[model samples]
Target: MSPSKPTSRQFEMQLEIAAPRGAVWSAISSDTELRRWFAPDAKVVPRVGGEILWRWGDLHAWPQVIEIWEPGSRLRTRYDSSIVDGEGGKLPLFLDFFLEGEGGRTTLRLVHSGFGPEATFDEEYDGISRGWPVELRSLRLYLERHAGLDRRLAWCTTTIDLAPAEAWERLTGEEGLAAGSALDALTEGDPFRFTTPAGDVFEGLALCCESRAFSGVATSHGDGFLRIAVEKCGGEHQVWLWLAAYGPAGPGLDELEARWSTMLERLFSASGSMSAGV
Candidate 1:
């Protein structure tokens, strides 16, 4: 008897942006533009058989092999086998980008396909499902609002053994990010305001609120974007806080990073003895 064919799963999303086609193309296919919002560092060789690198600091560098490159229209890539999840991964996981734009506004579609239906693929599958929304929204924010400016970013991430919901509660606790009950009364697209434990106030339209995630504009930070997500990886809940500020006052991101990092550690880590940050 012949062996069974592996089943596959995928994710798809679309966006409408107030930017030109060339700009959107560069944002996805160019290494320089990708570094602004997608990841801390990136490298792209924009052709079939070439490679793209998605780097997270000095630790993780995810690589993909380009399979199709159509300049401003479409690009497709397959996963590089070296980074497969443990031992049971089926190769050829693909990411496809399709763009159609005219005049000053453009529509972009993303399809991430070729995932296996096995437990080994669970961690990465979940990670990508949670991560891409944050990255893509950062892209839209860059093109529509902060285009052509160097982005200043402050990011903090920590992992706790707790479930995502529990970790999220601690993240929004009175002693932490401290979002008020006013947010609970707000709905998507509704104007909202809240203050953090650090005495920072933010006012913006609500964009997202989930048991494990929260996102909205940070109008006070030079009209910047703020996102917090709790991701589950290999049974551990990882909380990530990312802030992107544009214009002259980018919030001294390094200072903010140090501050938030200490906050997360004290709130989530085994020891509450870490030093206080900015």
Candidate 2:
């Protein structure tokens, strides 16, 4: 074997998107274009050997360098950062995007590799595997639906005083998402829709669904992407909710944030009273 590949270290995925190769290329390589669907803030120089910077507010910044560039055909970038290793050491991660187009359709293939050995395998692989599909769908929505429009982004985090497992239960419970109720009947590429108690409908293609997280394209609103994830830190479980609107109007960011905050508070409040047998 060629230096025996680490288990799940390299992930390759391809999807056909309803857009031209140029559109797909711009969505991935252009800094301002990426902000609409990829990162909250992006700065990139398109040529090979150029520096690319992506940021999610003050929470994280992944600085990458363009390794290869062929415009609408192929592009490769490398990220060397201590953030992924989590030990103040740099780890190299590569992201390759290849595109082939026929008429108005483009096949986009992504190769993400360079994850460290088994010592850091699960933590890195698990997170990226669950995230890529949703991100790809977001890309599709951006290129196919909102090619030249601006987007409104909303992000929020809610911390529950319960363990990860317990908080996960409530999130997927009947009163919460109850994803299992609909998940069993849904399959990949199939239409997935869920109506919240407050009458908001979340519709999309059924993407990734696991015990701790769920993500999909929000078809109810064109060019929208939604991810709801719960991760445990210390004694508390934090629920992260991220949604982006590529459309020009409606569902303002302030209103979206308030809605999510109220929903989280209600879930924890109800769970608390039930624990006290109220």
Candidate 3:
């Protein structure tokens, strides 16, 4: 006889919103409204077997393959995180949210299942416990203040250094390679625009710059800071840049950091090579 399969465990959370079922459903169902609270960047195809893409910054926040979509009732999906890790595979788990109407009030029940035998139910449960409160709070505030959708906000920064002479070359080098190339391709004079792998773009602008130093702030997605400076620390032609981003604080911070770090690394390498020849 084959071994009996282990029973799957599930966790759930419930919330009561002082809103009509239709209002609550619209908040979760519409992609634009969903981005206001759940993610700063997201695209949703609300249908069975459709896909939902969520991004927090310059990274893949999380992608969910829709399993069920019942307008004004329930939404079910399978979470997939494989875009970040090559070895990542789909886990035996799924999530569902059921929205029900109750005489001028809306009740939302979130359920997670398929936690296998070795699952850390408590750990997973605890993490989401805190997360939901903050997210939901934002949702409530958004609905009350904006009638349902919150304004999008985001910020980004870039800082680096090079020898004064080399810096000048790149800042004013070949006709098409001056200030245009000094900054990231996504950057334009004054305002800088960055597009994530998932196709979500953020807009900002240069706020400051000087000899061997540059800084900027962008407004639209949120508040972002960027700085670039050059100094001979330990005499090795060091260039340092710092970018601190702030937005809705979604599920893509780690991935955004990784992608930005790689981009900066490449920028530094190329700048260094040019500096060497100066």
Candidate 4:
């Protein structure tokens, strides 16, 4: 019985945060800090070989074991199928976090490795590939701006019979989001302004933008964050919209849920007659 190691395929991401390394380290290691930005709830054991548990509602994001734990430099975790996924046939996965910089700025790099290059591995690989960028944006948001504040999440989702890119157009297009700039002209880190059909105005830097996902900060909404992604679950493409507001002074959560839930339903559901849930 040895430690699990990563296989061939892996993904990496790096971002600069305007926070001290110790603060960045704490945000990734402390359970309470993780809850503020990463997941809805979290639990962490402090030492090497300790557990790092992340939960969204009743579902586990992915339970993992700490492999390396350095104070302000690096932290690595291993994700074994047996203890975490509760399935067979997949290799163990690893998440490595590296921090660099001095003073009030730090560069954080993430490596998620150990994905088998088989067709069966697509779901896990694709999901992680799409998810981490969004999560890390939240991390930077917390450390740089909203440290120590609690977060409230407003989520809405539905499924459509369209491709991810097309769904994105509908999400950011005229009849859809009516953003300040068209999807074709948008790039990551660029400023974006959009008024949702329900009158939610988001004017923030684009955090994540791809064929399948979009996330950004809403400076107008108490610096709230909005993440829109399309995931392929089963036979249909699932549309997920998450709005994160730290502390207070943002829009009403219950009202946002209702408005965006109905917005998504009216936009994507009518064409596909999809199931709507929040």
Candidate 5:
């Protein structure tokens, strides 16, 4: 029998955002605009051979150099630390962005490439494929509704003692949202607005609700975005939550963290499954 063809290492994603080309370009090019939704700390030098960086509060940093910068049209960047080979040497990666617009809407295309045949490379590629769509949804939401707004960040993660499918259901369901201190049901392309018991009101457009996760944009006080996902590993379920609230100031992080932590416990309690931190 012939050997099977090797799996392709490159991936591409397209997002049509409800904004003009200029707006979409800024969302991708400007650091100020990026921090509102994309990453907590972002910097783009706006010139070929300049820098493009994403730093998440000292947790980790991704640094790249710009290769092509065409305003409102295209961008390409190269990162030296994109992959780590088994010999501990760094491999190169490239990211290309293309934008086109008509009728007040912009289509953004992202191409992420530079993976080798190593097992480690395949794992990285899979993780990025799952993550890019969610990140693009956030970019669209920020530009369409929350442009020019600042943001405060809050994130909570927990490992639940339930299966991935079950956890996904409860998290996307109305009751599950309520457990997360959010009182709303999510519907794709529909308005999602709710107030938690803590008196925090969040409003946004529901982007996607699938078997794996639920994601949406914020329309409330600031340009906010959220995504919740469930992954199954080693006979257990892990749920992760990411929330970015737009504005110079908002709810305290301690309170928001506590609320989400409580929500996770409540979710697992309903199924009589005790959770432990991952």
Candidate 6:
């Protein structure tokens, strides 16, 4: 009997953004800005059938032709390249993007296909899985630092009253307090383990922390802020809390707020009896 021909496979990457469709469309469709995050050297022609190329030094990426372009709503493309398979054979590729807007949020979905049967889907998936987070972060930073750029993410803020020393204790000390709730414990350098009330655990990093401020970045939760200040009531200490959550507008905001508030209250209650050490 004759051997069967190899079958093609598919891959995908997706993210729900807090910003509007127009904002995301501008960032992704613009050649100059897209290069800042998506690639070191990238160029795109927005019209249908136009070509998009991205390269960095000796590493050449697959060429993609615009398949569908619906302004802020959707953009799809087909990859015209030879991706090496495990057995040293080349395979064709196809990719697509689906963008949907709901109220004040947007959902970005990416689908890549045409991975021949011999292709290593796991390898490709792993690389893209790790790379997207960094790219998304770069995207967030770009939109934020640029004054005229629209903010696509939502913000949450709260205040905690404590002394500088006490605030530090609640954040860093292990007093079985709930402050440790929202706070993930740093294991190596900034690396930390994050856990949610729903029992979902994520690996993250404490990007910055000091007597007066703290900041962290989590893969599942994005970024957060905790700042300390002298209380207006004199001699007392206070902490300002802030967090940014990505994806479409959903129940996540209220849930995050509740968890954060509970954690803060626990932290305060636990550290309340401790005397100022700073």
1-278 per-residue lDDT for model 3 (tens digits): 99987665666777777777777777876788776656667788988989887775542266778898898899888874222223565554587889987666788888877664443444444435434544554454445434543453322222335555565344323321133444433322466654444344445666444445554553533444444444332224444333434335333545554554454455555555322100
lDDT of every model, 2 decimals: 0.76, 0.73, 0.54, 0.78, 0.72, 0.51
Give the TM-score (vs. native) of candidate 6. 0.47
Candidate 4, residues 220-250, lDDT tens digits: the string is 7788887877777544577777888877744
Residue pairs clashing, model 4? 7-114
Reference-based lDDT, residue 144, model 4: 76
Q: In model 1, which range of ten residues has the least summed lDDT?
A: 269-278
> Looking at candidate 2, what is the lDDT of residue 86?
65
Clashing pairs in 6: 19-152, 162-237
Candidate 1 structure quality by residue, lDDT tens digits, 77-145:
888432465577846678999999899998999998877787766667767776676667779888998
Local lDDT at 196 for model 3: 43
**Clash count per candidate:** 0, 0, 18, 1, 2, 2
| lDDT of candidate 5 at residue 141, scale 0 to 100 | 70
Instruction: Write one digit per residue (lDDT tens) for candidate 5, span 1-278.
Output: 99987654788999888899998888888998888777778998889989999976533488999999999999999887446656877888889999998879989999998876667675567667777888888787777767777766666656666666677767655555643423235467777766655565667777776557767766564556766777543334568777776655356645776676787677675554433221
The per-residue C-alpha lDDT of model 3 at residue 175 equals: 28
The positional error of residue 124 in candidate 1, measured at the CA in angstroms, is: 2.9
Poorest 10 consecutive residues by lDDT, candidate 3: 171-180
What is the total number of backbone clashes in candidate 3?
Answer: 18
Off by over 4 Å in 5: 1-8, 81-88, 158-187, 190-205, 218-223, 231-238, 247-254, 261-278
- C-alpha lDDT of residue 138 in model 2: 76
What's the ranking of the predictions by TM-score, best on top? 1, 4, 2, 5, 3, 6
The TM-score that candidate 1 achieves is 0.86
TM value for model 2:
0.80
Best by TM-score: 1
